[model samples]
Target: MSFNVALSGLNAAQKDLDVTSNNIANVNTTGFKESRAEFVDVYAASLLSSSKTKVGDGVLTAEVAQQFSQGSIKFTNNSLDLAITGNGFFATVPELNSLETSYTRAGQFKLNQDNFIVNSQGGHLLGFPVNADGTSASVSLSTAEPIRIPTASGAPQKSSEVDIRMNLPAGDSFISSAPGNFDPEDPLTFNHSTSVTIFDSLGDSHIMTYYFIKDDPSVNPNEWMLFASVDGKPIDLEDPAGGGTNPVGGNISGPLSTGGGLTGARLVFDSSGDFQSQIPTAANGGIITSDFSNHLPNGADTSQTIQIDFNLDPLGPNPNEPTQFASNFEVTSLQQDGLAVGRLTGIDIGTDGLVRATYSNGTSEPLSRIAMVNFANEQGLKQVGNTAWKESITSGEALAGEGGSGTFGTINSSALEQSNVNLTSELIDLISAQRNFQANSRALEVDNQLNQTILQIR
Candidate 1:
């Protein structure tokens, strides 16, 4: 009986040592939770025996319980590395086709060869699908999928419309009215010039230059002649070369007579510097139309018409409307509706767990949202190695939710959760376990000596 009690004590001490050693060993492991050894005293008893002086047999190992307390967060350089600030675990999958889901606190993630975010063990980080508005498609854990980042955003889009808002110097010198018309080759003909890059159907870029020439002040004080060109080629206006719709037969002079030369509209400003009226051979609400289909490059669509809008409504936003200020000609704002194939530039995670991807085209798109899961009893989860756990009967079904919602924790991107193990406490526990083991061994030695003495007496 004594030997059995001593042996049990020895086993309990060894179990305590094992638990403490494990805690110390994983002190630096990311998201590692420390465990504790629980024990209870064993006593000999009968079915209905009432004994006030009952003696205990020995210590028995009850359970090895894990401590799931929050660990300190450390920020890292990688944006994919994540850390949970409160409660909940990151849901993951071991493979693409795996049906079972694993929960983990470790968030040391990186992009795999295929650009899927995964852990070092190749386990994919699961996330909920997101809509275009950055909302999660579903909150169920079963619906979570591996996160994959798209390298490129579809195809290129051709420029169809352009919006321009600028100030034309109202005090510039006037040019010769009749003989000195707007010319792209002669700088003296135009007072100010600005250019904007426009894309074609094939993503080829072409510079569209706008030239403004102040008219003779004596004849038209509030009038300014405009000239449009593309890559130095004149853009033909709907109005003929002469004043109105009539096409003057005589050949024009200077650059206006060139092959690509095109007549432009005239801008008139009120005395208060506000826009008054603009006259062109053909225009719709102050918007000039150009057919780039004739100048399409590299098999691009030649029938594409580009709308140039000088939305200079006096009632429009002050910054978006053109002003005839006595200042240098400046383009306040120039916007276009075309972009080339976009390359992935950066990725970010929001407090709501929405993963956003930014492209070189100055656009952002929602990729996927990180999925968080909570259990009724975290201690009931069965450890599956690699700082992860598997669902068990004791652990109730995983409650799936987005980060920062309900009892779930907010995800800190570009960070990692350190191990919960306390090295100082583990070292103290180690020493205590060693003393307990020594005491148990001393008891066993005494029992052996007593047996030897009894045999000698016999």
Candidate 2:
């Protein structure tokens, strides 16, 4: 009986030392939990009708339960490196078709070739996917997709119409009466060259030139001012100061750009008696139009629409005019509107476990509010690898809750919780385990010696 008791002690001591060794070995491992060995002393039981016929043997090993106290989290420079605070584990979705859900505390992640956020094993991180409005509820952990941070918004639009819209000051130069009778056949012309940006059918952009010369009379001595419109609105047209007032010569004048000179047509009385020109000629650039309001059947203003579409196909028989694009742009209002363009810089976890991302545009957003779980019997949890545990029949269902609620602790970013293993306590326990094993071995030796003496006496 004494030998049996010593044998039990030795077994229990050996188990205790093993558990301690494991704890010490993984002291630096992330999310490693220390475990405690539990033991139960053997009891004698009666086997006869009075229940006193037999006695139980020695001690028994009850269990080696793990301590689930929160481990400290250290900050890593990688934005994808994540750490969970409190009791919750991250849900992961494997990339392959094999349906398997894995939970982990290791937040290390990276962007896959397709820009998917995935772990080292290519398991995608799970989270409620956000919509264009940045809100969602139809998603779950099992169906979470990779959340990609966008670099830019939609494509830049082409200039369908080049609109030069401005009120050219009605200057004192206008004789008010004499300037109104300006004729195109005679010659007092203001020649100017203006640059235009045009876009091709493939959305490629190009530069085009428009030269204007006002045909006024030399006898009038009044300089003729030519107005230029790119798409629909009037655009700035000025030649290199030395290019003089004529950007285009006589043979290349008017909307047609044909070898022939401009044909004079009757300036008509419109339905509103407005002085509307009868000829489809585009003086300067094209008839000033706003929002596609201008009309000319055979004008340089092609069907291209806007200035962003200004490029023409020189390959065509007549590159000057098949379908002209409109170019209308207003830059005054751009400065007036308070707009912001920012990029995501970094993300930080709050003490309350909220992940907040900062942007280069001086803006920030809450990525998600972290969730944690608690259990009725933590000791009953079945330990899985990687500092994670799963609920078993012994451990009750996980009680999911937010941080700062119940016994759940709040998380701190940039700070990790240190291990609960106290070197001093471990050292003391190690010494006790060693001594206990030695004492049990000595007792066994005594039992052997006593048996030998009895045999010798016999």
Candidate 3:
């Protein structure tokens, strides 16, 4: 009995040493959790034995339980590296379409050949589908899929509208040439000129120049004539107030004949330099509409029409309209509603695990939301290799949710979670286990000497 007790003590002390050594060895490992060895005294007695005289047996190894505490975060330069500040695990699968899942805290992730995010072991990281506004469609683990980034260029959009605000010089001289003669090549034909780049349906850019010709003040006071040309070809502006019909408080002659004719839109201002009205009004809120189909580049959309908005708002108290001020000509604002084909620039991941992709066209699109999972019993998880775990009977079912929601933690991009093991505590435990082993060895030696003495007495 004494020999059996001494042997049990030796085994318990060895188990303690093994557990402490493992904690110390993995102190620097990423996402590693430390474990502790537990023991209980082994004692057995029959009902006839007196309780007061009973002596306890040696210690027995119970279990080596893992401690799933929070690990420190270490930042890195890679944007794909992730770390959880609180509770949650990143769910992954061995294959792209595999449903068999494993949970891990190790966030060393990179893009594979197919642009799918994967870890060092080639496990595909799972993410939930997201809407266009960056909201998750579903948070269930079953609906999660492997995230893939598209390498294609962003879609192109044709120019539909243009908002321009400018101050025309009130003291500028009229055109030296004929009243309706506006030439893009000759500076004397127009008072001032400004050019803007506009996009076609095929993502091609073209220069659209606006020529401002101060009309003969003797004929039309406080009035200016605006002519537009695309690629140096004249484009005709549609008469919004119907053909041959002039607007109120405006001096506009009958519509000019089409087919290579030099026509212009009339801009009328009040005495105080405030924009009162414009010719070709009554349509599109007094803005001029021009169809560039006749002068568009080959293979471009011929039906695309651009509306030039002078920011005229009669309802608002302080409308952002173009002004004919005494100051020099200055354009306060100019913007076009068009986009060219965009190439992939970079990627960003937010705290809520939302992944967004940026493009060269100044546009960003939401790709996916990372899937996070938590178990009811983290300690009961069966440890797999590579600091990963599998669900077992002791561990409850995995509860899936988005990061920074519910009991889950926020995700930190470009960071990693270091091991939670404490080296100083592990070293102290190593010394204690060594002493326990030595004491058990001394007990065994004493037991052997007692046996030798008994044999000598015989």
Candidate 4:
């Protein structure tokens, strides 16, 4: 019995030493959690034995429990590296479509050949689907998919409307009074000119130039002629009310010209330099709509129409309306609703686990939301290799949630979670286990000597 007790003590001491050595060895490992070796005293006695005289047996190894605690953060330059500041684990899979999910805290992630985000062990990181507005569509783990970045260009959009706000010079001289005198090649034909780039249906760029010609003050007082040319070709504006000949030019022979010159829209202003109305009343609020179906580029949408809005509101006093102020010609704002095809530039991950992709066309789009999970009992998670764990019976079902919500922590991009093992404490434990092993060895030697002495006396 004494030999058995001494042997059990030796085994317990060796187990303690092994646990301490493992903790010390993984002190610098990323996302490593230290473990402790627990023990329980073994004793067996019959009912006939006296309780006061009963002797206890040796210690038995109960279990090796892992300590789930927060690790220190180590920042890096890679944007894909992630760290959780509180409770939560990043869910991953062995392959792109594999459903065998494993949870991990190690976030040394990089892009694979297919642009999917993966850890060092090639485990694909899972994420939830996101809406157009960067909101997560679902938080369930079953709906999570591997995060993949697109390498192609972003979607292109054609120009539909343009908003212009400017102050027309009130003191400018009338450059032309004769009809059909406006020519894009000659500067003297128009008073002022401005150009903006608009997109076609196929994401092709076309220059839309606006030429402002001050009409003869005596003939059309406080009025100006607005001529537009797309890609150097004249475009005609449809009258808001009905069909009517352009006041500046005689009639529209083809798309936007009469007698080889571009016809112009009449801009009428009040005495106080406030815009009153247009001659043709093309659209409500003096907005003009031009159809470029006759002059669009090859393989482009021929029915595309662009609305040129000068005033935001027609009935109310709008400060964004065009003015004939006595100041110099200055365009306060000029914007168009169009987007060109863009190449992928970079990616950004927010603290709330939202991933967004930026393009060279000055556009940003939400890609996905990283999936996070937490178990009811973190210590009960079965250890898989590579600092990952699998859900077991002891550990309750994985509860999926978005980062930075409820008890889950915010994800830190370009950072990693270091090991939580304390080196100093582990060293002290090593010394204690060594002493225990030595004492148990001495007791075993004593037990062997006593048995040998009893055999010799026999």
| lDDT (Cα, 0-100) at 235 in candidate 3 | 72
Residue lDDT tens for model 4, 1-458: 88989999999999999999999989988888899999999988998998788888989999999998999999999999999999999999998779899999999999999999999999999999999999999999999999999998988889987888898999999764333566676777778888889998888888888888787788678887777778887776665434546644434222322455344577778778888776666535544546777678578887887777787455745798889989999988889989999999999999999999999889999999999999999989999889999999999999999999999999999999999998889999999999999999999999999999999994
TM-score of each: 0.90, 0.54, 0.92, 0.92
**Alpha carbon lDDT of each predicted model:** 0.81, 0.49, 0.84, 0.85
Which lDDT tens digits does candidate 2 get at residues 1-458?
88898899899999989988888777776656789999998987655434555455667789998887777678766656666566665555566444454555556667787755676777765544434443444333444444444444222233444533211121213233222332322233323335555543333444433332333333322223343343333332323222222332321123322232222111112222122231222434333212222332333234443322222223332222221112222222101111134456776655444555677644566555444455688778777665556667787765554445566656554444456566677778888889988988998899999989989994
Q: How many clashes (backbone N, Cα, C below 3 Å) per candidate?
A: 2, 52, 0, 1
Q: Worst ten-residue run, lDDT, model 4?
A: 249-258
Top candidate on lDDT is: 4
Model 2 misses residue 251 by how many Å?
Answer: 32
Which 10 consecutive positions of candidate 3 have the poorest summed lDDT? 251-260
Candidate with the larger TM-score of 1 and 4: 4
Who is ahead in TM-score, 1 or 2? 1
lDDT of 3 by residue, 1-458 (tens): 78778888999999999999999989988889899998989888898998898988878888899998999999999999999989999999999879889999999999999999999999999999999999999999999999888888988788887788898999988764634445577787678888788889988887888878776788787888877778877776666555523454333332222323554577878778888776766366644545766877578888887778886766532447888889999988788988888899988999999999999988889999999999999989999889899999898999999999999999999999999998988999999999999999998999999989989994
lDDT value for model 4: 0.85
As a TM-score, model 4 comes out at: 0.92
Which ranges in model 3 have alpha carbons more than 4 Å from their true place? 176-179, 241-259, 286-288, 316-319
Q: Rank the candidates by TM-score, best first.
A: 3, 4, 1, 2
